[model samples]
Target: MVNKKPSSQPYNLLPEAAQTLLALMHAQGEVARLSEREQLFSSLLDSVNAVLWAFDWESRQVLYVSPAYERIFGRPAGLLLADFNEWRDSIYPDDLDYAERSLAEVLVKGAVEDREYRIIAADGKIRWLSDKCFINQQTDNNQRVIIVGMAEDITEKKQLEGELQRLATTDALTQSSNRRHFFDCAHHAFATARLDQAPLTFLLLDIDDFKQINDTYGHQEGDYVLQRIADTGKAVLRRGDLFGRIGGEEFAAVFPGCTPQIAQQIAERLQREIQRLSFSHEHQTFGVTVSQGLTGITDADESLDSLFARADAAMYQAKRQGKNQIVSG
Candidate 1:
């Protein structure tokens, strides 16, 4: 048995002190966990090659920026966070409106994914970036937070896609519209002509004595002649006309809203233009000539194939008659 002395403090006070100490220890543990998490996040920021950032909805101010900004854009992360307008102004002018509209759409929709834009770097280089982001609302419901978005460079990919599209629609030799592209435009023109009851004409042209020229001057000279013919033909045609290299030594033109008489005149003019062109290669100078076949759209019952066949027959007639003239069908 122990002798007990009367104490002023209640027994509950001792338990409360112990509880406070435990609570303090738990808080310290949480701080340590948070510190470790921050360090991990920083490491992640440094490892990526893309720009990662977050912002506030109301101020449109950047709240966080990843270390990758320095590596890719040649600017410190702090500069971007200090003034987001600097970043906005640095964007390519052509892409600025699109970028702003996309951001606004995302803010309204509460999320944005796979938006692409072009940003100017500190080194004065334009870079295409693809961004993905999420929106977070504040607990008090008065403000909104935008989560960190990652932006990856995609300039090279976009350029390659553009080049591929150009190649698909362009002729490799003449640098004009290809056969398929020509047909596509012709189809549209045909549809329009049928709707408006307008006349449409086609000219099928063949290089007169092309094989003989190739045999005499070599294939290189033949190619030069063909290119010159294409150039001259384009120069003489109107803006609305479509011309294309359809075959080895054959070309075609689609003239929309042209009657049979006008088509005949155009074919004759093209024939004269080709005859007037004087080409020289390796000390040899010679004039080029072409035979053209003209056909006009008469009725809705006419098909593109049938019209083309008539033009081809007329061209063959020109070839049979002389080899440097226009035949109308």
Candidate 2:
């Protein structure tokens, strides 16, 4: 009975306490690993150049959006996530209807891949996007319908395609339609006129003694004259009229739904405009004139070639008559 029984020190833990402590340590380690994995996934999304998004269709709420949303759209991701209308408002006014309709189509079609449209960014710059979307047909545990999509910035690609089209269809020196493109359009117009039984006029014009000017003032000055004449033609022609430089010193025009009398009036206007243009080379000042041949579509005409032949012959007639006049065929 020393009565030292159960010393004042706390008692040691039982076997059950040790097991609980080890279990708690294991859970903490797992949580740390999960957090690191989550961070890695988010970093990957931020590096991408396209916007990836997930939406809860039933709730009309944005579920998630990648970091690229801010860069391409020039708007904050938080704003878009808070209000889906932020996206609808960014669409170009003219394309808004099509963009919304096409997006809705994804619900029925399962996926949409060819959805290209324009958007006005926050910075007031216009951008083009090739947005593709897919619908997950199955509902989640919460009965939420989700729509997933990716939008890529294709503005540079669109611009390159436009430039290539211009190079293919336009003359570099005069900035007018080239011969090949002009004939292509003219052929289409001729067929339409024939089918609709509409009146169409064709005019062929040649600069008077253009070679003499080129030889006198050199090719550079000759190019300047050609450019000015082309500009005048563009300015005088009706909106629907097609004008082009068809040869070195020859240009042509097609007037759809125009009678020969009205076409003559337009030709006279073009003539006056050209006459008003004066050029100087060295110490000499001079002016140039044009000889034109006019023809109209006829019941017997079979193709554009017939119209071309008549107009060419008539143009030569103008050349023979005076060199500065119009001849009708």
Candidate 3:
């Protein structure tokens, strides 16, 4: 068997121009593939109502932006890439530092869950956006790369949440804080007063003969009386004082940094005001009155239950003595 020698010409050799053209072809193919992927992604994003973006970590330059950018940001995607800092500059001044810090923390930590911020659009409209991003750690180098974020408009949802919170904490009838919310606030006030050694007083009031009023004048008139009492109480109270409708015809007020004497004065004033109010329904005029009980936190017992019990006892005492009077315990 004869062993043949290999040819002198380089076995893998091709013409220089052909190789160059081949390299160019491969590059073009890659670019076409990427363009197709981007188009598909853009179409997907456009189908829904969300903004998508990608930024190169090293250059801090925007690499890809979905069409929704124009809808949300009111600017062409090209403009965002043209000036890398444009997007950052559009953040609200109050949120700029916080947004930057949050982004930096996520970049350092290699992932981000969700964050909310306000952005100024090209049309000068301020919009709230919730952004979510994740870092791509399986890169060829140690260079940190973060997947650009997706932002969704959450203004309506946030507004609804605020409204719900208000409804939960406020009394529907009198528009004052409800019993549940008042309890929470009073607990905090008690804690603060205990810590500061400041005097704290509470006033528990009930409309005298409320059941009789409801039966005589009808329930609507009774409701009107309650509303009137709430308004008058609010008007006379200081700014830091807390008042709430605890139950039907029953109201409570928490006075932090107030002594029992001051609370009694305020209670007396409220009693006088209620007696002065005259309600006319269907050409019939009637007078309304409230019995008030006042109690201060004492060294014997510091619990809310104890304080409330004392106040309640005092209120019942007032009711027993007379329909309209202030009793202190």
Candidate 4:
């Protein structure tokens, strides 16, 4: 866990950011005090996992770099000090335009700046950096302005955020897309199909006699059956097809650029694959089959709800005709 600094209020004291900037602000005379303050800032920054530096805004020349450069950027401090290209080259190419624009905003407004971007370190490993900056001081000549900032390594934080997002979007048991994420993907796929005038197939699959399975084998085994069904259906679906467990004992798929004939063939293959799965529960070997409702994008299909309603109607038709069968609309 991260530690928080003490929040005690002082008499007529400035905020944390203002205090930091005040310490960094340059003044005429008091050379000894300035040197001591510089040493204090350098020491404090060195103790933390951040690279503190300053540069000329106009000339883009490196003015100062802290020792932490070696640990974070995987290079010696002298390298960054030697040439501006070293710093420029480390920035990810795709993020360059945005970084420049953000910095330009900072220069114009003199407001504090913060941005997150990727960097390629000297070791050739990609890293995430949270860079922060503000104008520390401007020269009396106005030819050059001092920009001060620190870069913090945020790769681990970014990875954790990504994992959290995956967990939120994924079904825990079946390891497929959850209901919310399924619709999010389907909406995008729906727009693309409409624009390109492409054939898009939708499948609503339901397990036959799912409640009976739970009654006989228990909920744990019923979950296993559902997993097997999802696995089987995914194997039969084409690449780029969207598959998700929308409900208990029910799954859905969106197949873009696939015809109804091909969708029916894949549904048949999925049924066969489920039939091939056998589970030994309470010393009894048994299998389960699925019923599917298939539908394609039509000229009359104005919304996802309409398309899903058509497929859902066909799925119920399959259930009415027989437990294990395919109904197309």
Candidate 5:
């Protein structure tokens, strides 16, 4: 049996001119292939909305960044190319630790990481970004560990979520906390007050002759009156006070670390503030007042309902005693 191997010819075996032409053609073909590959990579990255970036972990230097970085981060690519600190400095101080911890996780554990954080852009505006990144271990003689990552601008999505949360927890009529949110805050305040044995005051107010006002002035005017009452009450309340419209024409306020006497004084001032609001109907101008009931947290055993009921009774007492006054329970 005869064994035959593949034939081979060296370029030197050819004429000099022919060899040069062959080498030139081969080089041209290689160039064309590289050009095609570069075009494909550019097209793929250009179509993606996210920022693509790579860096050497050891040197802490950025090797490459896609064009989207300029568009999304609002900074020139040359800035990131020159120094990675420029990108690091753009992170919001509050979120800097969070971003660093994510990077540490990837570096130490050799894992992919996804994190959301805020950055101050070149435009002096805050932006939210969702970053997904991974570290590629050393795979070459240079022992270079590369970090590749992508980040997408999520500022608009975060804003939308915040709006939804506000709508869920806020009263539409007066822009005050809604019933559920009020109780949520009140419960937390109650727990804290109990733990510290601090005096927590609660105030409940009802619009005087609210139903009659609605019947006489129409719902729109009634709404305006309620709005005015809420605005006035909020203005008179202190900074730490929590005010909420727990019911129609009825509102509740909680003052942590306040005495019943001081709460009553604040309520009286709120009543006066309400009386100052001028409302005109047809040709008549009139002002309305609120009847307030105030109470302080007596003990840990008292539930929110019981304490609120006491305040409600005092408010009705105010209604019976002259219609517009502040009464302490």
Candidate 6:
């Protein structure tokens, strides 16, 4: 019997050659499809503006980061993939704790959709981000935990919100708190003072003969006078005190934790500041005076409205007796 060596060429192995060739062809086709799929995904990731990332929870490793990561974060994606701490380092110092803690919550909650935070970019500019993250549980029966997230820049949205808030709460002409915002704040302070039995003072001021000034100097000069008086009030008020423009020529201030004596002194200083502000129009320089009504918290005072009423009466009394003076109610 002749013992022949097995043929090295696959085709010579007649019995199994067909199966082997078919398997090889199928594998080649699958490889090509996989390559095309990967390229398609890479293109899609790069086209977007949000940063997409995947992390391995068990090893604390960054498994993948999309091209948008570098563009949005202003840092190299390679650094983040190499060390997860690079992502953590980019978070704003004040938001670092909340960012980390909220991310960890995804493990229990399965998803976190409303995570918004601030980050310091490579250029030393602050950018706001709305980051959403979720746990990937479809692989291997969740034996290994993975986190997937997309972070989008929302700086413009945040800025718009801030501007809208300022517009709503601020007086455009004088740059002071508007009437509504002032009353809201004063009401809150009044409640707090009543609860704590703390001292609080309220001052109501009106420009002396403001209508006459407008008639004599024109509305533009009247506006200038209003701005200067507002500036004086802002300068003279102590920190934690609230000042606002409540009417055309009327401003109100709330001095939290102030005694009657201290509030009187503050009002006097504000009057002096206004007197020093001299405005020239049509070859004549004129100064302004503010008639102020000062009132302090009393056991009989039930609400901020009561304080305002007494202050209002005292201010009218100052006007009648002779303007440019402070009357305590």
Model 2, 1: alpha-carbon shift in Å? 42
lDDT of each model, Cα atoms only? 0.84, 0.93, 0.86, 0.85, 0.88, 0.93
lDDT (Cα, tens digit) per residue for candidate 5, span 1-329: 99998657677987899899999999999999999999999999888888888988888999999988887778999989999997899999999999988976888777655689999988989999999888887768998989888888899999999999999999999999999999999988978888898888889999888888888888999999988888887888999899999999999999999988888778878887788889999997878878888888986456677778889999999999998888888
lDDT of 2 by residue, 1-329 (tens): 56666645433454677667877888999999999999999898888888999987777888888999999999999999999999999999999999989989988898999999999999999999999999975555686668999999999999999999999999999999999999999999999999999999999999999999999999999999999999999999999999999999899999999999999999999999999999998888999999999999999999999999999999999999988888889
lDDT of 3 by residue, 223-285 (tens): 999999999899778889999999999999999999998888888888888888999989999
Worst 10 residues of 4 by lDDT: 20-29
Model 1 lDDT tens row, 74-107: 7777778888887688778999998888877766
Collision pairs in model 1: none
Higher-TM-score candidate of 1 and 5:
5
Error of 2 at 227 (Å): 0.5
lDDT accuracy of residue 250 in candidate 2: 96
Instruction: Assess candidate 5 and give its lDDT.
Output: 0.88
Error of 6 at 312 (Å): 1.0
Q: What 10-residue stretch in candidate 2 is worst by lDDT?
A: 6-15
Per-candidate TM-scores read 0.72, 0.90, 0.75, 0.75, 0.87, 0.87
Of 1 and 4, the candidate ranking higher by lDDT: 4
Q: Is 1 or 5 the stronger prediction by lDDT?
A: 5
| Candidate 1 wrong stretches, greater than 4 Å | 1-47, 67-97, 117-127, 145-148, 195-199, 256-269, 301-303
- RMSD (Cα, Å) of model 5: 4.9
Runs in model 3 with CA error above 4 Å? 1-40, 55-64, 73-97, 118-127, 136-147, 272-276
Residue 148, model 1: lDDT of 59
Give candidate 6's total backbone clashes.
0
Candidate 6 overall Cα lDDT vs. reference? Answer: 0.93
Which 10-residue window of candidate 5 scores lowest in summed lDDT? 299-308
